[model samples]
Structures are given as structure tokens and as C-alpha cells.
Target chain A: MSINKDTIVAIFLLLFCGIMINSSFDIEDPGYQGMKASFWPTIVLCLLSVMSLVMLIKSMVSTTDNNLNSENTNSQNIFLKFKNASICFLMFILFLAFLDYLGMLIGGVLFVFGLLTLLGGFEIKKIINHSIISIITIGIMWSIFTFGLKVILPEGEILRIW
Target chain B: MIDVILQAFASIVLDPVTLGLMFVGTLAGILAGAIPGFTIAMGVILTLPFTFGMTAIQGLATMLGVFVGGFSGGLMSCMLTGIPGTPSSVATTFDGFPLVRSGRPGLALGLGLWSSFFGGMISAVILVALAPQLAFLGLEFGPWDYFSLIIFALTITVSLSGGNITKGLIAGLLGLFAATVGEDEINGVARFTFGFDDFKQGFAFLPVLIGLFAFSQLLTDVEDDKRAKSPLMSQSGTVVKVEHRQAILIILKRWVNLFRSSFIGIFTGILPAAGGSISNILAYDQAKKASPNRSNFGKGEYDGVIAPEAANNATAGGALIMMMALGIPGDIVTAVMLGALMIHNIIPGPTFIQDEPLLAYGVFIAFFVAHFFMVGLQAFSLRIFLLVTKIPMYVLASVILAYCAIGVFALHNIVFDIWVMFFFGVIGYFMKKLGFPLAPMILGVVLGKLAELNLARATGISDDMLLFISRPWSLFFLLMAVISVIFPFYQEAKKETLFAKLYVPVSMIVLSLPLFLMGSPVRMIVAVILVLTGAYFLYKRTSSLKIT
Candidate 1:
């Protein structure tokens, strides 16, 4: 028997609520206060758990409607969509990692260049075009934020030599 | 007061620095709004940190430029490619695209621009006049009343969540939960920090907002297989020459629609969470009902273009009114603006008007200047608008990703917020995939602190939980919340006879089980209501099913 995606989501949220409730207990209460630090979180966790249970049951019961189930399954290539989003997500994680060591200017340029190549592929002309645009964008952004705005961005130890 | 207003206006107009910044800001806003997949809200969020370095009026002046320009810029893509640049301009595509297809692209573009300007002017006038009165009302609200007002605001989720109350409520509750992660405002004790030092300051709403909206959108764009489609500029179409004066006069002749739609835009804008999306659709509906050439509407009637365009642009003024007068944001953009203002140490609301009347009035004057600048800028920059659509998706996506990273980093020179943004981006993506709406979640984040603070204040005063319902204003709001939540269910039930049948017995069992276990009076009352309504619906459904 195939488990419905809706049921899977409901189960995931149910588990998240369980964790949230457990975490809520660790929140130190303000002694005899009107509402404790954990008060709203606990209420929300209870509501969320109840809602997740209903959602799970609803998905289970609605499985008899083959039309709805088929419609949900046949909407798009979920695997392909997940793959593409995962690539971008990985690229973003890389960008975040780069920002600390490379500084905003260098890290931003590398991220833009890398992402453009990832999306458009490694055509020489396009890569060159992407590189030029990335440089120009980073140069302007660095100057504006660093000099014009006087907001200090992370200049990393390596880039501090410059 | 008049002298102060004049002085504020003079300071803005005479100072070349402010004037130039406003022009640049408007141009940027137009570019931001004109780009497909970029929203005015996103534009406002991206622009917030830049305003940190500028004066209050100057920063606000620049943002106003973005606000006005973004609304007007959406018309470009709608006419040219039949794709709305922003959601607010979705209706503009129906008639504007048809007009473009008929080779009167110039007329559609011209009429839309002029309508936007006039609609913006009308809303600005009303905002100037009505906001002071509304602010006076806001000033009278005590803690109990303020809590009630917030409840009314939260119910906006019912209208916005695309007819899914349970999902909307869950999203809202999730947002409220996220808001509690930081130090407790009352006790200074951290909640839900999960032992991370970074979580102590909590997730900054700005970074979180950019993540949910801009970053998540970028992620979705990347997931599209055909993300590298040919630029819109490659399409060849004739733009018939339009007489600007003649077109303006023709749009002006529909004075009833202009005023009516603008009023709808303003009123809807003032309502918390009801932004241009609702206003445009409502205005279009009203115009269709009143139009003599109603049948011609969807078939390229100019009135169709005028109504939604006018209404949506007018929403800018209407939204600003709430932000300026009551200190409550009517929508996401204003919420961001409130954040920016707080960053500059300028508090909005009734006290804003009383203390910084000149600055408050300066903001009003800034809108007028921004609209005027929008007209001049949009008129001569038609070629640039055409070029904006031609930007490649990958390049755009990459630039935005970098911008998001840089913008969040610039906020406090911290990278933790960027990580928080990334975390929320993943959550937002999954939520969207699961058919949950993000608007309610964002609204929850914006209003959560307010709601918590006010509820605490009110509860402290009353010393009884039941006092919330005993207060007349609070009771009224709770009643409104009930109606807002149940009315949609009621409407859905009326449509689905089978659902009404199944829902009743199921809800009765569900409610009764909890009531039996808990033995709470409130649970019993709720269960009783469910049984009665469920029984009535079940009976009606059975009768209908039998007849069938």
C-alpha cells in the first residue's frame, strides 16, 4: 500500500510538534506569572498536534477518492523539481560558507559566477558574460555598503590584507 | 500646522540630496516591480537596510519612491507579455494584453500609467484627510481594545489563506511560535532558543521575511526546467502611437470608476492584511457590475485596465495611512516600513503624529513627490521597461541570491541571521509545496509581538481569563474571528453536500471525544455546537442525497 504524501506531511508535522513540546518544557517559567514563557508555545504545540492528527485522518479517509489521489500524484515531476531545488539549496549553502572566509565582495562574485554556470551551464561566452556581470555587481555593492553607507560587512582575515 | 507642513515640503523639495535619492529610489522601485517574480514587498525589504544610514525623511522618501514606482512598473510586463510583474497587477493582464495583441500596446501602457498616477493621487488625498481621524480613534483604545483589534487583524488569515482555514491557522500558529524564540519581553527569559547563542537575539523579522519571500521564490525559479527562457524583449509587436493627453482624458472621463476603485483600494488597504490583491479584484468586480459596457470588459474594454490599475496603485496610499496613523501595518510592505522606521528610532502611530508632525507630514508630502516622479519617470522610460523583461532568469536569480545574502549581512554585520533566513527558506518551500499559505505566517510574525504584549497588558489589568470575553470590544472581535473562521467553512459546506454530511458526524465524534476526556465546559460548548450544526447539515445532505 502506497503512503499518501499528505499523510507523510502530517506525520512529519506531528513529530515536529512532539519535539516542540519537549523543547517547551526546557523553557524556564516566569514564576506564577500571567503567562509563562512556555505558555503560548505549549498551547500552539497542542493545537498543532491536534490539527496534524486530523490532517492525517482526513488524508487516510480520502484515499477512496482515486481521482483526488491521482490528481495530486500526476501534477508534476516532483523528483525533478526536488533535484533542481536541491542544487540551488546546495549553492546557497556554499554561498553562506564562502561569505565568512572570502568576504562579501569575493564571496558574492564567486557565488554569482558559480550559480550562473550551474543554471546556464559552462558555455565559454556565457561564463565570461556572467563573470563580467558578477564583478561589476560586486564592485558596486561593496563600494556602496562599505564606503557610501559606512556599514561594515565581514572583510574576512584573508581579504583584510587588501 | 500649515507652516510645519510647508516647511517639511520645502525641506524635501529644496534639498537636492533628498530629491535625487527619491528619484533614484523610484527608478529602482520601478525596476524592481517591473521584473517578473520580484514584488514590491521584496523590493521594500531589500531597500530597508540601505535606509539605515540615511535620515528618517530621506530614508522614507527613498522607500516611498520604491513603493510608488513598483506599483506603476507592474503595468509594463502585464501589457507587453501578458504576465503580471506582481500579483497586484494580475487583473491588468486580461485587458492590457488583449489591447497589446490588438496593436494598441501604447494605449494600454499609457492608460495604465495615467490611471495609476490619478489613483495614487486620490488615495493620497484621502490618506492625508482620513488618517488623522483614524489615528484619533486608535489613540482612544486601551489594552483590552488593542488586543481586540489584533484579534481582528489575525482573522485576516481567514480571508487571505485561499479558503483553507485549518492550514492558515496552522501557519499563523507556527509564526507565533517562531516569534517566541527570542527573549521573553516580560521576564527576559529566553524561550525556544535550543541552546544556540545566535537564537538569543531571535530571528530578525527582516532576514526571515526576505528568506520566506525572496529566497524561496528564487529557489522555486531554479527548480523550473525551462528557467532559461528567451527574454521577453525578443518578441516583436507594434505599439501604436497614443496621444497622451487624449488617453488621459478618456481615463478621466470614467471618473466614477476612478473614484470608486480608489476608495475601494483605500478602504481595503486600511484593513490589516487586505492589500492590493483584494482591492484590485474587488474594484474590478465593482466596476464590472456598474459598467454599461460590462460585456466588453474581459474582451479588452479599457475600463478593465483602468479599474484594477487604479485600485492597486491607490492601495499604496491606503496602506501607508495605517502605518503612519495607527502604528499597525496593513500589509507586509508597511510592516517592513515599520521595521525600518524603528531602526531609525522613529515610531509610527498616534504618537508619531503628535511628536514628529513635521516628519509625519514629510512622509505624506513624500508620497505626492514620489507619485509625481513616477509619472515623469515611467513616461520617458518605456524603452527601459521593455529591456527589464529581457533579463535572463539565472542571472536574475543568482544576483538576487547574492543580494539576499549581502542585505541580511549588512543588517548587523552578522551571518547567523543569514542562516536563519536559509532555514526559513527551506520551510517556506515545503509549506508552499504542501499548499500552506505564507501570507498568514508573515502576518503572524509581524503581529505576534504586538498581540503577545497587548494580551499580557490586558490580562495583567483584568486578572481573569474570562474578562477578555466580558469586555464588549474584545467580545466583538472574538465574534468576528468566529464568523471569519466559520463563514468560509459554511460556504464550503453549502457547495459540497457530501462534505457537509461527512463533516458533521466526524466533527461530532472528534469534538465529543476531547470533551469526554477533558470534561471542560468550553470543550462541551464547542462540542454541543458541532453536534447541532453537524446534525442539521447531515440531515440536509441526507435529504439531498436521497432525492438524487
Candidate 2:
């Protein structure tokens, strides 16, 4: 279901109010009373809520450019939104999973190659060329980070086996 | 003064390590900046783990170089195509693409390069002269001021929300709400831990930022790509066409708007919290407002191209003031520099200036050298940056996801951050889908800890909440914040309500109560001047809006 701005904003306002109400219960001990942390947070929340209320009124009264008119939905698809984002998410998981198993050099190489080829749709021949370039560049990065700069990387499966 | 800067310059130039660091920093920064989606600060933060191995100077020098380059490299995107490489270059795209369309990519590039360099130089001169005085003044700011200032910053986000201001505030407040999770900033009590030790550190800032900026952006990009009707968009391809003479004189002519915007950029940059993104927007807006010819704007006016281009790039010199003088960071990039310094156990406040004078000077010298390298390198390698812009949407989308995960894992080697990231990604997606601005949420998260900590310190007692308002600087910001909040409502209501029309003068007097309570007479004078200026904007916007 396409959510309205009012609905989303309403949820936000509800959450802020809830948080402020809950935080108000926080009364610190007497000695620490002067610098009581909750005090400032409450102020921030209170101001936020007022600003939010003002926003809600504005949105409610605003014009109809939303999904009630199918024209808006025609231009924006929810699934397409998830698809591009998922590629990135999936690649990240791959980067992490291999960071230790492949060693920094090999792992970075595969990750970039796999990312480029899989996501980029390069043919096998182009993959090899791109992989070679990526690996070489990563080699420089590895030396720069580990050798010269001293950043540590996971040794992963390669180091364990060797 | 010349001798001082000269000595500082010579000291920095003589250091082999500093020289090397500057080169590496500038080059790496240019690469990071040229590519869309990679921020200079994000680049530094991503590579921070590597900096753990280097000295403080080396680490900071490299980050600064990258920051400068990232801001400068954006011009390529603006010039070659209408799209901005970075958010800071959105204004550049206004005229930059027009210039390209007019067959003057070289002029766009040249103007971009020199004006940015000139802007940085002018800002440096200002910073070197006035930073100490400014820093001393900033030191006087108390807790209430922070409380007010952050609120004021948060309020500005509402203006950016675009039509549905409430949704924006809601997202922002939700972000503030998110900050309360994990461990309490004070008393170490868990507010929203829900019972896991995982919540103790709160959500990792960088990971959350990655999710919000990079992850959510990926989702939006994917949606954008999916909806693309062009068969050419999906076909993975390489196309590079550069046809234009380098117009150096065109750059020289635009120096008028370029310098005007640059000065505005420098001043805004000197203030804490304003970063490249805001500097560019404000500079573009200022240029548009100040131009005698407003209709030319957004249609590819030359001033539109240079205003943001110069300001966004110039702000780097301005941010250095806060970094070198006060320990306070103006933005995330400087914050990363602070972290680098911390890794070296090098404290950054006023003492940093006296103790590491040459090191600080070296950073300054590096900025000069780095800008020169960035412009020269980009002029030749324009193809590389443009080629990056050509990546098929599906493939680019995947890379965005990959980086988000990498960034999530980078923070603490914890899978927990991945969850926070995904959660924020979902949150950010909805925020965007619902018309809320994500910048406020991120800013809210960034300032949350500082405001809490400062307020606690100011109170000096756990029980006395009111102590925050007792101080001068704190009260001043608080008053300013009140004005910021009420002014919008007043402005909006003036046209629609007879009550507002009848009572605005009296209500304004009441609204300006915080000003009257000022501790410094100087602050009072500034406040009055500000009120008058604000009134002008308020009256103008409201009247125009009502008329429409």
C-alpha cells in the first residue's frame, strides 16, 4: 500500500511523543541533578514535537499529488527500489564473507571482479581484464594500507592454509 | 603576517613525509570525489582504518587532500553532464551542463578549477587572520546555546522537507529518537536496550550514515533505474565523447560571482555544522538572490555554475579554522581528522596550534599543492570521471549495496551494525518515499551526543535542568532558536490569519524575549540586526507566497 505523507509523519509524531513521555520518567539522583542528561534530551524532543505538529497540519491541508491519483504510482515502482539496493547489500555480504577467507588481496580482487561482472554484466573476457586491473590496483592499496600505513586485514582462509 | 605564513609554508614544504602525504592525500581524494556517491569525508572515514598505521600529520594531511579534491572533482560531473557528482555540486549542474551543451567543457572545467582555488586562498587568508578571535568566542558558548543551535539546525531541515514539512520533522525526530537507543549518554542507563548488551554503544554513527545515505540512495537509484524506459540504460556500454576548447578567459570573467559566493561559502564553512552540501546550496541561493538577472537562473546561467562550484570547494579552507582552533569539527570530514589525531594521541584544541605549529602549517601548504594537483590531474583524466558516470544503472546499484555493507562492517567488525544499517535503510527509504529529508536525521544523530554531554556539563548538577539557561552564550542560542522556530509559523500565518495580521507586532516583541535577556550587549546588537534581516525575508516570502 502506498503510504501517505500524513501517515508517515503521524507515526513520527507518535514516536517522538512516546519517547518524550517515556524519557520524562527519568529523574536522576540529587548530586548528579544539576547536569542531569535527560533534561536536555527532553527539551530537544519537546521542540521536535511542536515542529512535527506544525508539519502535520501543513501536510494534511496540502494539495493532492499523492497516489490517490494513479499517475504518481505509474512513475514510481516499489520493487525497482528494492532491486538496486539489494545488489549493493548482497555484494557487501560477499565482501565480508570473503574478507577473511581469501586474504585481503585475493578477497578484494574477487569482490571487485564479482561485483563488476555480476552487477556490471561484463562478459567473461572483460571480466578477466577488469579483474586483472582491479587486482593490481588492490595490490597497491594492500601495500599502501598494510605495509606503509599499517592497517590490519583479516588473514582469512588463505593464511590459515598456508 | 606574511613572514609567519611563509615560515609555516617553508616548514611544511621541507618535511618529506608531509610532502608525500599531501600528494597521496590529494590524488586519492580526487579519485574519491570524482566518482559519484563517494564523499570526501566518506572516503576518509572508509580509509580511517588504514590511517591507524600512520602518524597524525600523515593521516590528517591525506584526509584533507581528499576533502579538497572531492569537493573540487565535482565540477567534472557538472561540466560534462547535468548531474552533480556530489550533492554539493547540484548548483553547479545549473550552468555547468549548459556550458557543456554550449560546447565549453574546458571553460567549465577551467572556471571551476581556478575560482575554487582562488576561493580557497581568500578563505585561508581570512582564517589565518581571524580564527583565534572566532575560536575564543565559540568557547564562550554554553549548554543552552548548543541546545538551541542544534534545534535551529534541526529546524532548517524542515524547510528542506519540500511541501510536507511535518514528514521531514518526523523523520528527523525519529532520528533523534533513534539516538536514545543502546546506552544512555549520561548515567549509563539503558533507555531502549530492550535487554541486549549490543545496545550499549548505541547505533554506530558511520554505519547508520552509510545505511541512510548510501544504502537508501541505492534503493532509490534502483527504483529509478527500474523505471527507465530507455533500452540503452540497461545495455552495459562505454561511450566517451569530449569536444570543446578549454576556455580559461571565461573562468576569469565569472570571478565576480565566483568571489562573492566564495566569501559566503568561507563564512558559512567557518561555522560549525555547515558542510559542503549546505555551503553549495546557500551559495547558489545567494547568487540567485543577489543577481540582477534572476530569470537566467536554473536555465544555465554562468553565475549558477560558478556560485556553488566555488563555494562548495572553498569551504574546505573555512572548516580548517574550527579544526585547528577549537577541537570542534565543522563536519564529518574534520571529525575523522579528529579521530586520526586521537589515534596518535595528539590532542586538537588551542594547544594543537602552539605545539604542532609546523604540522598545522604543513596541512595548509598541502591544501595549496593539493588543489593544484587536483585541477591538473582532472583536466587530463576527464575521461575517467565521465566514464564512471556512464556505468549501467543496475551495475551501479549493486556497487552501492556492496559499499553499504563494507561501510557497516568497517565500524566495529560487528554484524550488529549490519542490522542497524538495514533498519535505517528501511527507515530512510520510507522517509524518502514519504517526502522526508534524510539530512536532518543524520545531523540529529551526529549532534545528539554532543548536546547531551555539553548540557550535562553545563548543569554541573544532576538535578538542576534549568542551569542550562543561566549562562550567557547558552541563553543567546536558546533565544535564537526560539526565534528560528516561531518565525516560520509567524511567516506562514501572517497571510492566512487576521489574528496574526493584527497581533504580529506585539507577538514579535514577546517572541523576542530571549534577546532582551542577553548577557553580552554585543550579542544583543547582532540579534537586533538579525531580527530586522529575518523580518525582511519573512515578509517577502510570505507576501510572494500569498500573492501566488
Task: Give the alpha carbon lDDT tens digit for every residue of A19-133 in model 2.
Answer: 6668556534444445544555566577667776666555566565353445445434544445545665566567666666776567766766675565555677767766775
Instruction: Put down candidate 1 lDDT per residue, B281-371, tens digits, no spaces.
Output: 8888998999999888877888998999999989999999988887888888888888888777776766688788888888899999999
lDDT string for model 2 (B154-214, tens) is 6554544344455556666767767766666567665556557887788877667767766
**Docking level for model 1:** medium
Compose the digit string of candidate 1's lDDT tens values, residues A4-98. 76678879989999998998888887586576767766876897799788777777776452233564465465566676677778888987877
Query: What is each candidate's DockQ, to 2 decimals?
Result: 0.57, 0.33
Error of 2 at B71 (Å): 2.8
Given candidate 2, what's the lDDT at residue B5? 62
Candidate 1's error at A48, in angstroms? Answer: 2.7
